[model samples]
Target: MTSDPTVEPGPLARSSAVTVTLLAPVARFSLRARAGDLAALSGALGLDLPQKIGDRAAAGAVEALCLGPDEWHILAPEADAGRLAAAAAAVYDAAPHSLTDISDREVTVMVEGPAAAELLTIGCPRDIDRIAPGRGCRTVMDGVTVLLWRDGPERFRLDIWRSFAPHVIALLRTGCVELATCS
Candidate 1:
């Protein structure tokens, strides 16, 4: 898998929006569980789940979050995503749960640096800072549902649907440039 400069760096992709600077190459994994098996499945997987998947990922080790009643989206380093998925499948496959590898189905953008929070505020309405570290939330940004993770004081992970990822990136990039030129 040669790197595609057009695709950005890391496991995420750079936003097409020139205003918002985005980190590249997000590794996305989707976990599917049987009805009523979310707790045991999560416990068996040993993930200290936060109140919300996206919010909890900000607590350091985590990279991104997604939510569903019997499903969750876990984003991490592309290289490690397969490992996590495989581990989960092995442990839960026989336990009446199903885990699918949807790493390629979405786009992940890591927004960081001094202006990350401010940049995100342009698209997200939630009080991002109040979200607390290590927690995630569901919100619409630039007309797309996103999984938001507060990676740090100025860092956040934004996961959007693959189809809408480019639009979000473009908008953010535009915001970044506009903000930069303003200040």
Candidate 2:
């Protein structure tokens, strides 16, 4: 490893009020289905696919976020990828749908602690405080599209494209310092 003083650790930031960290690897899927296929699809995948945009559903270790009436973003433990994919495909016998594996296309950025919402607002135009826990929506941060999930009043996660991660991290790093200093 190079002894570059400018290079910092992987965590986006960690301070008194908040902790921004990159989540461990997880399997991700972009699922699309017709209105009638929701039930069958959910049964096959073991997670209820929400019907309303921004709604989230969870079953054990799996979670699904409804980004649109016909589209969902699915997340699960990394080792479950192949098994989950096979299950989703089995639905093809009765319900015609699409499930594209997207595990490598993005990474999860988790912002936790009391200042989570406020930190997000640094680059997000929407009022972060309004996004209720258990729900998520497709939004932009610093012009990059992100799947914003509010896990609680003090915890949130942003699913960001891998290519834009560095840019996002830098902005957040600065935000964390500023927030701490301002507090």
Candidate 3:
């Protein structure tokens, strides 16, 4: 895949109401366990796993997000990968659970400013107006799978696969340009 010039740092794209910023590397873990084992899993990882779909919980720099009844995505500093993985292994030992490291497989982008929601709506089908803070869901933007979450009132984050990062960034840049021209 070609490197997307739109994500080359130093403010790739912006408008009076929207700006897209690429985020630093972060650790990511994909977890799956039965509801009955959630408590144990949480105890093992020392992370409070979110219970409801779209719900998100954070402990310091680590965050646990529920993607489904039995699926969760954990995000933390890349340095914590080993420690977190060890905890998960110990807790799920002999139990029917799966924890996989996906830290290097994805990239995170931050979209902020007043028009952030409108910019996302250009390609994302979810109702950005309806997503409350502390909630997120797996969705597609321009056909690329993404994890969308609101980090603040006018700020949102998109976690996209590494290979698709360029495509998504390009889309965001184009959206920003269009929004700027219209306003």
Candidate 4:
């Protein structure tokens, strides 16, 4: 399938209060396997799998996100998708599980600034203040499904479908403007 070039925009906005940056492309995979299979899975993937909900584990350029009891989302440099998929397939051989490449389906937008969490609270129901760094979960913003994660005390990353990226960035920019005016 061909993606619309017009929908992609660069650096939506920047401010001391909040700076929105479009992240470079990365490989993303959706994984579903039984908890019992984690050991082998981790060994095959060459990265420790996070065992707790909302937890994330990273080794080098690869990171694994535990989205559920038996589900995870893996992110890595675009060049490593094939290798990672191969490892997963080898590990899950004769086992029941699912692994899918979703790299091109979504885009990542990073929000960084002292008011980053506040800007996200405008549409997300989760209390951003409560989500500590290195953790994230699936949530919806303005009805758009997204994976919200805190990368640092003042930095947040939102993973949303490529189609919804523009709308989400616009909302974030609006929030930044509103916060600027309020302060």
Candidate 5:
């Protein structure tokens, strides 16, 4: 299918390289830390613990969010994925936290445009607005526990497990396609 050239602003569509996939509009990352070690993990990253990271995440300074007591997910541009993975690993290497490169294990999809929010409603029951911008929540979306973040009014980022990545993507594609047809 042809992309809507006019959908995104000029700079947003610019490519840095031909091989680099700009999953633009949406991207995802998975970060695993030892259970109960998230606080220490953040310290290594120069960020505070718990919801403190979420505060900075909203401003777009850093897109880090706590997924569980021992788990956290850092969302950024697809281009930054490699750097982020290494940075996180080096920080947690000798520490109590165990870091894993889950970049290839999950499907990160970006849902943008005027219908982004509406499309998300198909899989998410939470009030997307309640989470606010830059902030995210760990909730079960369509029976899947997903970390949903509101990066912008028309932008959102979803990180699902590697095994379920394809299914999640299919579901999203179906939802968005259904919206397009309905509208």
Candidate 6:
């Protein structure tokens, strides 16, 4: 048997202490705006957009993470794509910012367990332990750009580009075994 890169991958890592699975589809957007425009956009989107790097705010099924001084990554239920775009569009005139729908460009991988943070450090450049819970940062894993979300002390969500997912998942699975043995 042979593997084909063109074909999308199936399941990812799974373990008792650490697991990696692809989350169900969600609507994602890359928003770029100035500080003064955040209030208006947040009102329209129904969620406040964090301004400081690594900060995050959420409302309902929607969450906005401040990835930079003027950039944010928004995630919401897939069904809310139209509603989100419409709301942002409505605010464009007043806020004058960019909200690009990036739902299809990347996929969410949830990595959670007692050793989740250590597992991530295998390839991630940052000291994963340093990120405060409920915050996120744009970082690199095995040279791949990823948005690392620290949902809790033991839970993480990696928003990674689809093309590099296979490589990243493979690394994580191998790390799971390494950590499992060290226990």
Q: What's the number of clashes in each of the models?
A: 25, 0, 0, 0, 3, 0
Off by over 4 Å in 3: 1-10
Give the CA lDDT, 0 to 100, for residue 47 in model 2. Answer: 78
- Which pairs clash (backbone N, Cα, C closer than 3 Å) in model 4? none
lDDT of 3 by residue, 1-183 (tens): 236664444465789999998887788999999988888888877778989999998888889889999999999998888989888788665556999999878888999999999999999999998999889999999999999989888999999998888889889999999999999
By the lDDT metric, which is better: model 2 or model 5? 2
Select the stronger candidate by lDDT from 2 and 3: 3
The predicted structure with the larger TM-score, 1 or 6, is 6
- Candidate 6 segments whose C-alpha is farther than 4 A from its true place: 1-11
Model 6 lDDT per residue over 40-93, tens place: 999999988888899999998899999989999999998999999999899898
Q: Mind giving the per-residue lDDT tens digits that candidate 2 earns over 92-118?
A: 989899999998888788899988888
Which regions of candidate 4 are displaced past 4 Å? 1-9
Better of 4 and 5 by TM-score: 4
How high a TM-score does candidate 3 get?
A: 0.93
Error of model 3, residue 130, in angstroms: 0.9
Can you list the residue pairs that collide in candidate 5?
A: 26-110, 58-134, 105-162
Q: What Cα-based lDDT does every candidate model obtain?
A: 0.62, 0.87, 0.88, 0.87, 0.56, 0.87
Cα lDDT of model 1 by residue, 45-96, tens digit? 5564434444343323434354755556666666766666666666664556
Better of 4 and 6 by TM-score: 4
Number of backbone clashes in candidate 1:
25
Provide the lDDT at 142 for model 1.
Answer: 70
lDDT of 2: 0.87
